[model samples]
Target: MNYTAEAPAVWDPAFADADDCLLSSDQCVIHGEHCFVKGLIEIPVIGSDEVFSWGVWVSLSRENFSRAADLWNRPGREDERPYFGWLTTDLPVYSPTTLNLKTNVHTRPVGERPYVELEPTDHPLAVEQRTGITPARVREIAAAVLHPGSGGHR
Candidate 1:
Protein backbone atom coordinates (compact mmCIF):
# COMPACT_ATOMS: atom_id res chain seq x y z
CA MET A 1 0.00 0.00 0.00
CA ASN A 2 1.14 3.55 -0.60
CA TYR A 3 2.36 4.78 2.72
CA THR A 4 4.14 7.80 4.07
CA ALA A 5 5.11 8.48 7.69
CA GLU A 6 3.58 11.93 7.41
CA ALA A 7 0.25 11.63 5.74
CA PRO A 8 -1.80 14.76 5.03
CA ALA A 9 -5.26 15.47 6.34
CA VAL A 10 -8.21 14.04 4.43
CA TRP A 11 -10.24 16.39 2.25
CA ASP A 12 -12.74 18.21 4.41
CA PRO A 13 -15.20 20.64 2.92
CA ALA A 14 -16.19 21.73 6.40
CA PHE A 15 -12.74 23.19 6.95
CA ALA A 16 -13.57 25.96 4.54
CA ASP A 17 -14.64 28.97 6.55
CA ALA A 18 -15.08 32.68 5.92
CA ASP A 19 -11.34 33.01 6.13
CA ASP A 20 -10.65 29.84 4.17
CA CYS A 21 -12.18 28.00 1.24
CA LEU A 22 -11.65 24.38 0.25
CA LEU A 23 -12.84 23.22 -3.14
CA SER A 24 -14.08 19.66 -3.20
CA SER A 25 -16.63 17.45 -4.95
CA ASP A 26 -19.57 19.52 -3.70
CA GLN A 27 -20.25 23.19 -3.23
CA CYS A 28 -19.80 23.47 0.50
CA VAL A 29 -20.27 26.65 2.49
CA ILE A 30 -17.92 26.88 5.38
CA HIS A 31 -16.95 30.01 7.34
CA GLY A 32 -18.91 32.50 5.23
CA GLU A 33 -17.72 32.45 1.62
CA HIS A 34 -20.48 30.81 -0.39
CA CYS A 35 -20.16 28.62 -3.47
CA PHE A 36 -22.45 29.70 -6.27
CA VAL A 37 -21.89 26.51 -8.24
CA LYS A 38 -21.64 22.93 -7.12
CA GLY A 39 -18.63 20.93 -8.29
CA LEU A 40 -18.59 23.14 -11.34
CA ILE A 41 -14.90 23.84 -11.61
CA GLU A 42 -12.45 21.14 -10.64
CA ILE A 43 -10.35 22.18 -7.66
CA PRO A 44 -6.98 23.83 -8.44
CA VAL A 45 -7.14 22.90 -12.14
CA ILE A 46 -9.09 26.07 -12.82
CA GLY A 47 -6.17 28.01 -11.42
CA SER A 48 -2.80 26.45 -12.18
CA ASP A 49 0.46 27.71 -13.67
CA GLU A 50 0.21 25.49 -16.74
CA VAL A 51 -3.16 26.97 -17.57
CA PHE A 52 -2.29 30.52 -16.49
CA SER A 53 1.03 30.74 -18.36
CA TRP A 54 -0.45 29.69 -21.68
CA GLY A 55 -4.24 29.87 -21.63
CA VAL A 56 -6.77 30.45 -18.84
CA TRP A 57 -5.36 33.44 -16.97
CA VAL A 58 -7.07 36.04 -19.11
CA SER A 59 -9.96 34.22 -20.81
CA LEU A 60 -10.98 32.09 -17.85
CA SER A 61 -14.16 32.62 -15.90
CA ARG A 62 -14.68 36.11 -14.53
CA GLU A 63 -17.04 34.40 -12.09
CA ASN A 64 -14.22 32.24 -10.67
CA PHE A 65 -12.73 35.02 -8.56
CA SER A 66 -16.05 36.85 -8.35
CA ARG A 67 -16.94 36.02 -4.73
CA ALA A 68 -13.67 36.97 -3.07
CA ALA A 69 -13.08 39.83 -5.47
CA ASP A 70 -16.56 41.19 -4.88
CA LEU A 71 -16.06 41.09 -1.14
CA TRP A 72 -12.63 42.68 -1.43
CA ASN A 73 -13.93 45.36 -3.76
CA ARG A 74 -16.13 46.76 -1.05
CA PRO A 75 -14.46 49.24 1.33
CA GLY A 76 -16.51 48.28 4.38
CA ARG A 77 -15.90 44.60 3.76
CA GLU A 78 -12.19 45.12 4.19
CA ASP A 79 -12.59 46.73 7.63
CA GLU A 80 -15.78 45.28 9.06
CA ARG A 81 -16.05 41.72 7.77
CA PRO A 82 -13.67 38.85 8.36
CA TYR A 83 -10.99 38.64 5.69
CA PHE A 84 -11.60 35.75 3.32
CA GLY A 85 -8.57 33.83 2.07
CA TRP A 86 -7.32 33.51 -1.50
CA LEU A 87 -6.31 30.51 -3.61
CA THR A 88 -2.51 30.25 -3.89
CA THR A 89 -2.38 30.78 -7.62
CA ASP A 90 -5.09 32.56 -9.56
CA LEU A 91 -4.79 29.47 -11.77
CA PRO A 92 -4.38 26.47 -9.44
CA VAL A 93 -2.76 23.33 -10.88
CA TYR A 94 -3.84 20.00 -9.46
CA SER A 95 -1.24 17.79 -7.82
CA PRO A 96 -1.33 14.22 -6.41
CA THR A 97 -1.31 15.36 -2.82
CA THR A 98 -3.59 18.14 -1.55
CA LEU A 99 -5.56 20.68 -3.53
CA ASN A 100 -3.97 23.78 -5.00
CA LEU A 101 -1.87 25.91 -2.67
CA LYS A 102 -4.02 28.44 -0.81
CA THR A 103 -3.07 31.50 1.20
CA ASN A 104 -4.79 34.16 3.22
CA VAL A 105 -4.93 37.38 1.27
CA HIS A 106 -5.66 39.33 4.45
CA THR A 107 -3.54 42.01 6.10
CA ARG A 108 -4.87 41.30 9.60
CA PRO A 109 -2.90 38.04 9.95
CA VAL A 110 0.24 40.25 10.14
CA GLY A 111 2.98 39.87 7.53
CA GLU A 112 2.96 37.77 4.33
CA ARG A 113 0.12 36.62 2.12
CA PRO A 114 -1.15 33.07 2.72
CA TYR A 115 0.26 31.48 -0.44
CA VAL A 116 2.51 28.52 -1.14
CA GLU A 117 5.83 28.87 -2.94
CA LEU A 118 5.57 27.65 -6.52
CA GLU A 119 9.26 26.87 -6.83
CA PRO A 120 10.51 23.34 -7.29
CA THR A 121 11.68 21.65 -4.08
CA ASP A 122 14.94 19.66 -4.13
CA HIS A 123 15.52 20.11 -7.84
CA PRO A 124 17.38 17.27 -9.53
CA LEU A 125 19.01 19.67 -11.96
CA ALA A 126 20.50 21.63 -9.05
CA VAL A 127 21.64 18.49 -7.21
CA GLU A 128 23.19 16.99 -10.34
CA GLN A 129 25.78 19.77 -10.47
CA ARG A 130 27.26 18.49 -7.17
CA THR A 131 27.46 14.95 -8.58
CA GLY A 132 30.53 15.92 -10.67
CA ILE A 133 28.46 17.00 -13.66
CA THR A 134 30.76 19.97 -14.20
CA PRO A 135 31.58 21.84 -17.39
CA ALA A 136 28.97 23.58 -19.57
CA ARG A 137 30.30 21.71 -22.63
CA VAL A 138 29.72 18.36 -20.89
CA ARG A 139 26.17 19.40 -20.05
CA GLU A 140 25.63 20.36 -23.66
CA ILE A 141 26.94 16.94 -24.78
CA ALA A 142 24.71 15.14 -22.28
CA ALA A 143 21.70 17.15 -23.34
CA ALA A 144 22.37 16.41 -26.98
CA VAL A 145 22.86 12.71 -26.23
CA LEU A 146 19.69 12.42 -24.17
CA HIS A 147 17.48 14.21 -26.66
CA PRO A 148 18.87 13.36 -30.08
CA GLY A 149 15.79 14.67 -31.95
CA SER A 150 16.09 18.05 -30.18
CA GLY A 151 18.49 19.17 -32.95
CA GLY A 152 21.22 19.74 -30.32
CA HIS A 153 23.01 16.51 -31.30
CA ARG A 154 25.22 16.03 -34.39
Candidate 2:
Protein backbone atom coordinates (compact mmCIF):
# COMPACT_ATOMS: atom_id res chain seq x y z
CA MET A 1 0.00 0.00 0.00
CA ASN A 2 1.09 3.58 -0.57
CA TYR A 3 0.12 7.10 0.52
CA THR A 4 1.66 10.32 -0.72
CA ALA A 5 1.85 14.02 0.13
CA GLU A 6 2.34 16.52 -2.67
CA ALA A 7 4.39 18.85 -0.59
CA PRO A 8 5.52 19.61 2.94
CA ALA A 9 2.67 20.41 5.33
CA VAL A 10 4.11 23.87 5.88
CA TRP A 11 4.27 24.61 2.18
CA ASP A 12 1.94 27.38 1.08
CA PRO A 13 2.38 28.27 -2.53
CA ALA A 14 0.19 31.34 -2.15
CA PHE A 15 2.73 33.06 0.05
CA ALA A 16 5.77 32.02 -1.94
CA ASP A 17 5.38 32.19 -5.69
CA ALA A 18 7.14 29.99 -8.22
CA ASP A 19 10.28 32.11 -8.51
CA ASP A 20 10.73 32.15 -4.77
CA CYS A 21 10.31 28.42 -4.33
CA LEU A 22 11.77 25.39 -6.00
CA LEU A 23 9.77 22.20 -5.80
CA SER A 24 10.44 19.11 -7.82
CA SER A 25 9.37 15.49 -7.51
CA ASP A 26 11.86 14.80 -4.73
CA GLN A 27 13.34 18.16 -3.70
CA CYS A 28 11.82 21.35 -2.37
CA VAL A 29 12.98 24.78 -1.24
CA ILE A 30 10.41 27.22 0.05
CA HIS A 31 11.23 30.87 -0.58
CA GLY A 32 14.89 29.92 -0.43
CA GLU A 33 14.40 29.06 3.21
CA HIS A 34 12.95 25.75 4.36
CA CYS A 35 14.39 22.70 2.64
CA PHE A 36 12.66 19.37 2.20
CA VAL A 37 12.94 16.12 0.33
CA LYS A 38 10.40 13.46 -0.46
CA GLY A 39 11.23 10.07 0.96
CA LEU A 40 9.60 6.77 1.74
CA ILE A 41 8.71 5.59 5.22
CA GLU A 42 8.64 1.87 4.48
CA ILE A 43 7.12 -0.87 6.57
CA PRO A 44 7.71 -4.48 5.66
CA VAL A 45 4.77 -6.87 5.37
CA ILE A 46 4.96 -9.52 8.11
CA GLY A 47 4.73 -12.68 6.02
CA SER A 48 5.82 -11.51 2.59
CA ASP A 49 8.55 -9.58 0.83
CA GLU A 50 6.13 -6.76 0.12
CA VAL A 51 6.36 -3.31 1.69
CA PHE A 52 3.97 -0.54 2.59
CA SER A 53 5.29 2.94 1.88
CA TRP A 54 4.29 6.41 2.89
CA GLY A 55 5.51 8.93 0.36
CA VAL A 56 6.25 11.81 2.66
CA TRP A 57 8.48 14.83 2.95
CA VAL A 58 11.17 15.45 5.53
CA SER A 59 12.66 18.81 6.45
CA LEU A 60 16.43 18.90 6.39
CA SER A 61 19.08 21.35 7.41
CA ARG A 62 20.44 23.54 4.63
CA GLU A 63 23.74 21.67 4.77
CA ASN A 64 22.09 18.29 4.57
CA PHE A 65 19.78 19.41 1.80
CA SER A 66 22.70 20.74 -0.19
CA ARG A 67 24.62 17.54 0.29
CA ALA A 68 21.66 15.46 -0.81
CA ALA A 69 21.15 17.61 -3.89
CA ASP A 70 24.81 17.38 -4.73
CA LEU A 71 24.69 13.61 -4.58
CA TRP A 72 21.31 13.37 -6.27
CA ASN A 73 22.58 12.02 -9.58
CA ARG A 74 25.85 10.53 -8.39
CA PRO A 75 26.29 6.82 -8.67
CA GLY A 76 27.15 4.97 -5.43
CA ARG A 77 25.58 7.81 -3.43
CA GLU A 78 23.65 5.18 -1.50
CA ASP A 79 26.79 4.42 0.46
CA GLU A 80 26.74 7.85 2.08
CA ARG A 81 25.64 8.10 5.69
CA PRO A 82 22.01 8.73 6.51
CA TYR A 83 20.95 12.34 6.95
CA PHE A 84 19.03 13.47 10.02
CA GLY A 85 15.75 15.20 9.29
CA TRP A 86 12.34 16.09 10.72
CA LEU A 87 9.22 14.56 9.27
CA THR A 88 7.31 17.34 7.48
CA THR A 89 4.28 15.45 6.25
CA ASP A 90 1.39 15.00 8.63
CA LEU A 91 0.02 11.48 8.34
CA PRO A 92 -3.56 11.54 9.60
CA VAL A 93 -3.73 7.77 9.84
CA TYR A 94 -1.96 7.69 13.20
CA SER A 95 -2.46 9.60 16.41
CA PRO A 96 -0.32 12.37 17.94
CA THR A 97 0.42 13.49 14.38
CA THR A 98 3.32 12.38 12.16
CA LEU A 99 4.80 15.85 11.91
CA ASN A 100 8.17 16.69 13.36
CA LEU A 101 9.10 13.10 14.04
CA LYS A 102 12.83 12.38 14.02
CA THR A 103 14.04 10.43 11.00
CA ASN A 104 17.14 9.10 9.32
CA VAL A 105 16.99 9.58 5.54
CA HIS A 106 18.88 6.74 3.97
CA THR A 107 19.82 7.53 0.38
CA ARG A 108 19.36 4.79 -2.14
CA PRO A 109 20.23 4.38 -5.84
CA VAL A 110 20.18 7.42 -8.09
CA GLY A 111 16.55 6.98 -9.07
CA GLU A 112 15.11 5.67 -5.83
CA ARG A 113 13.72 7.88 -3.12
CA PRO A 114 15.50 7.98 0.20
CA TYR A 115 14.31 5.54 2.85
CA VAL A 116 13.02 7.35 5.90
CA GLU A 117 13.67 5.42 9.09
CA LEU A 118 11.64 6.79 11.95
CA GLU A 119 13.22 7.09 15.36
CA PRO A 120 12.54 4.13 17.61
CA THR A 121 9.80 5.75 19.63
CA ASP A 122 6.58 4.52 21.19
CA HIS A 123 4.46 6.08 18.47
CA PRO A 124 2.37 3.60 16.51
CA LEU A 125 3.96 4.52 13.19
CA ALA A 126 7.43 4.12 14.58
CA VAL A 127 6.51 0.87 16.24
CA GLU A 128 5.19 -0.52 12.98
CA GLN A 129 8.30 0.63 11.19
CA ARG A 130 10.41 -1.32 13.65
CA THR A 131 8.12 -4.36 13.64
CA GLY A 132 6.63 -5.69 10.45
CA ILE A 133 2.86 -5.46 10.09
CA THR A 134 0.42 -8.11 8.94
CA PRO A 135 -1.46 -8.18 5.65
CA ALA A 136 -4.60 -7.31 7.62
CA ARG A 137 -2.93 -4.06 8.67
CA VAL A 138 -2.12 -3.22 5.07
CA ARG A 139 -5.70 -3.91 4.06
CA GLU A 140 -6.90 -1.68 6.89
CA ILE A 141 -4.63 1.13 5.76
CA ALA A 142 -5.89 0.80 2.20
CA ALA A 143 -9.43 0.97 3.46
CA ALA A 144 -8.72 4.09 5.46
CA VAL A 145 -7.07 5.90 2.58
CA LEU A 146 -9.66 4.85 0.06
CA HIS A 147 -12.74 5.56 2.10
CA PRO A 148 -12.00 7.74 5.07
CA GLY A 149 -15.59 8.68 5.85
CA SER A 150 -16.60 5.04 6.05
CA GLY A 151 -14.15 4.47 8.89
CA GLY A 152 -11.89 2.06 7.07
CA HIS A 153 -14.62 -0.09 5.59
CA ARG A 154 -15.06 -1.18 2.00
Report lDDT per candidate.
0.27, 0.91
State the displacement of the C-alpha of residue 73, model 1, in Å, after optimal TM-score superposition.
6.0
Count of steric clashes across candidates, in order: 11, 0
**Worst window of 10 by summed lDDT in candidate 2:** 145-154
In terms of TM-score, how similar is model 2 to the real structure? 0.93
lDDT by residue for model 2 over 1-154, one digit each (tens)?
Answer: 7999999999886745678798778988998888999999999999999999999999999999999999999999999999999999988778788899999999999999999999999988999999978999898888888877656422
**Model 2 stretches with alpha carbons more than 4 Å out:** 152-154
lDDT of 1 at 61: 28
Candidate 1 has its poorest 10 consecutive residues by lDDT at 51-60
TM-score of each: 0.19, 0.93
